[model samples]
Target: MAKIKYSPEEKKTLKSMFWNSGLVFAGFNMVKMEGNAFALTMSPALEELYPDVEERKKALVRHNGFFNTHAVMFSLIAGITYALEKEKQTKGSVDDDTIENIKAALMGPTAGIGDAFFFNCLRIIAAGVGIGLCSTGNVLGVLLFILLYGMTQIAARWYLLRMGYSFGTSFIDTVFESGLMAALTKSAAIVGLTMVGAMVAGMVNVNLAWTIKVGKTSVVVLDVINSIMPGILSIALVFGLVALIKKGVKPVKLVFGILFITIVLAFFGIF
Candidate 1:
C-alpha cells in the first residue's frame, strides 16, 4: 500500500467511478453498494494488505457491508494521498507505513458517516420526505420529491469530494472529533425519529380486527390501545427485536416470527 498515492490517471479513474457509482438509488442498500464499489476500486491500493488474489477476494467479501458495515473507499483515497504525501516528505519517500496509517485513520470516520448519514439519515430523509409529498397525489409532490432527493445526493457527493480533497489526512480529526459531528448526528437522529413516527402513523401494519360492544356501541378496541400507547409500543417493539438479535436470533427468523404472529393474531381477530 506504500506506492498507493493516487496518480493523475488514478484520480481520474476514481473520480469517474465516484460520480458514476453515486448515481445509484438503492436507498438503504447504498451502504453495501458503496462498500462493494470501494472494495473493487481499492483493490490495487490494497495490494500490500491483501497481496494474493484469493486473499483479496476474501477481503472483498469479508469487508463487504453486511450488517453494521460501512466504509467508502473513494473518499478514503483522499486521506491516503494526504498521508502518503506527508510521509514521503518526512521520510524522503512513501512506504507501507504511510498507507497503513491512512487506512487506520480514515476507516472509522468513513464508517461513521457512511453508515449513519448516507445509509440511515440521508436515505430516510429522502424517502420520508418524498413519500410525504407523493402521497398527496399532486404534481407538486412528485416534483418536490425528485428535487429534494436529487439535491441531497448531489450534496453528498460534493461534500464527500470536498472533504476528501481539502482535509485529506485530517478530515477525520476535523469531522468526527469536532462538535459538528455530534450536532449533526443529533439533528439527523431527531429528523429520522420524526420520520419514523410519521412512518408508524402512515405505514406500520398493525391491524385492529376485533371489536368491543358496550351498551349498543361497537368500537374497535385495538385502535384505542394503539392510540394510547403508540410511542411506547414502537419503542418496546424495536427494543424487543434488538434484544432478540443480541441473543443471537437471526434477523430473518425475527422477521418471520413477527410476520407469523401478525398473521395468526389477525386470523383470530385478536390483532
Candidate 2:
C-alpha cells in the first residue's frame, strides 16, 4: 500500500486542534497552582497513605498517557468546534456528552501536571530568583526574569504540543485502560493537598481585631476565629462558593457575590 498521508484539510484540522489543546494546557498551568495547593493542604492523610512506588512503576504508561489523548482529543474537538462555529455546520448534532467527555477526561490530569511542573516548579523558581535579584534591580535581574519566565513558558508549549500531536493520537485508550489513571489521580490528590497547605500558610490572611481603649483600661481580646487559623475563614468562604457552584449557581453571580463581600469587609477594615 502507498504511504498514507494526511490531506491538507486533515492537516489544518490537526493544527487547530493542537492550538486549542495548547491554550487549555497553558491557561490551567497559570491558574491551577493555588487550587492544587489548597487541595493538598486540606488532605494530608490521603497523601501519606498514597500507594507505593512498585504499583505506580508498573502503571507508568498509563501515568503519561494524557499527552496522547489530550493531543488527539483537543485537535479533533478544536476542528469540530471550528467547523461548527465558523462554517455554521449542523449544530443540532453536536452532543453535550461529547463536549463534556472531552473536558472531563482532560481537565483533571491537565490541572495536576500543570500545578506540579509549571506552578510549583517553574513559576516558584523564577519568582524566588527574581526576588533574590531585587536588590540588584539592574539590567541583570530584568534580563534574568525575562529569560527564565520566557523559557519556562516556551518549554511548556513545546512539551504539550509534542504530547498532543504524537502521543495523543496514537496511544489514547491503552493509557487509560492500564489502571494508571487511579495512580495518577492519587498522586494529584497528594500534590494538591501539599499545595493547599502551602497556600493556607502563605496566601490566606487572618489577623486580630484592634479596638480603641475605653478610659485607661484597654479592653483587648483576640479575634478568636481568625487567630486559630488565619486562612481557614477564607478557605471556608471558597468552599461555600464551590458548594454553591456545585449546586448549579452561575460562576459570574458567585464572582459578584465574592467581590461584594470583599468590598464590604474591606470597607469595615475586617478583611
Candidate 3:
C-alpha cells in the first residue's frame, strides 16, 4: 500500500484542526451535536481534496450528520476520515458509505474508552491534585491542574491524529492487538481511584455536633466517632451522594438538596 503524505502547510492545517476540536460542541443540537463543527474543521482539507466546487459541497454535506464522541478521541476519527477522503479523491475506489460506516463503527468504542480514561480517570485525578493544593491555600493549584491536563490533552490529540493518518484503518486493530489500550485504561483507573480516596479524606468534611447526655455529663458525638474511625462522616457523605447519583438523582437537584440540608442542620446546631 502506498503512503499518503501531507505537506508542511497541510500538517499545519491538521494542527489547527486538532485545536479546533474543542469547538465541536458549540453548534450542538438534538439532531447533530458536533456534526456541523466536524464538517467545519474538515473544511480546509476538503477544499484542498476536492477542487471541484460541486464535489466539495457534496463532501461537506456528507459530513454534516449525526457524529458525537469524546473531543480528544475525535482527532483519531478526523485523521482517519481525512485519509479515507484523500484515498477517495486519488484512487476513487472507497465509497462514501464505507467512510460513514467506518465512522459509525469507531465512534462508539472511542467514546467509551476516551470517557473512561480522559473524563473519568485523568480529569478526576487532576481535580484531586488541584483541590488538595487548594485546600492548603495554594492559589497556583488551579493553574497547575489546567496546565497539566490541558497539555496532556493537546499531546494526545496531536499523537492520535498522526497515528490515524499514518496507519489508516489498520491502526484500530493494531491498538487492540497490542493490548496497550486495556493496560493503559486499567492503570488510569487505579490512579483515579487512589486520587478519589485522597480527595474524600482531604476535601470532604462532615462532623456531628450532637452530644450524648448522661447524668449531667455531655459527650461529643463527633469526637467519639473520630476516635473509632477518622473521616467516617466524610466517607459516609461521599457514599451517600454516590448512591443518590446512582439512583438517578439529578446533580443540580442533589446540590440544592445538600445545601438546604446543610443550612437546616447548621441552624439546629447538629452538623
> Which has the greatest TM-score?
3
Q: Across residues 65-169, which tens digit of lDDT does each residue of candidate 1 receive?
A: 322124343454533444344433344444443333344344445556677876677667767877777787656766666666566656655456545544544
Clashing pairs for predicted structure model 3, backbone only: none
Error of 1 at 125 (Å): 23
Q: Which ten contiguous residues of candidate 2 have the minimum total lDDT?
A: 38-47
**TM-score result, candidate 3:** 0.60
Candidate 2 local distance difference test against the native: 0.45
Write model 3 residue lDDT over 48-73, tens digit each, in one string.
Answer: 78999999999998998768788888
Task: Give the worst 10-residue stretch by lDDT in candidate 1.
Answer: 62-71
- Kindly list the per-residue Cα lDDT of model 2 for residues 74-171, writing each as its tens digit: 33333322322221112243233332334334444555565676667876788777778877665566667767866656555544443443443333
Q: Tell me how far the alpha carbon of residue 196 in candidate 3 is from the true structure, in angstroms, after superposition.
A: 34
* Residue 223 in model 1: lDDT: 74
Show where candidate 3 strays beyond 4 Å. 1-5, 169-271
Q: Rate the local accuracy (lDDT) of all candidates.
A: 0.53, 0.45, 0.78
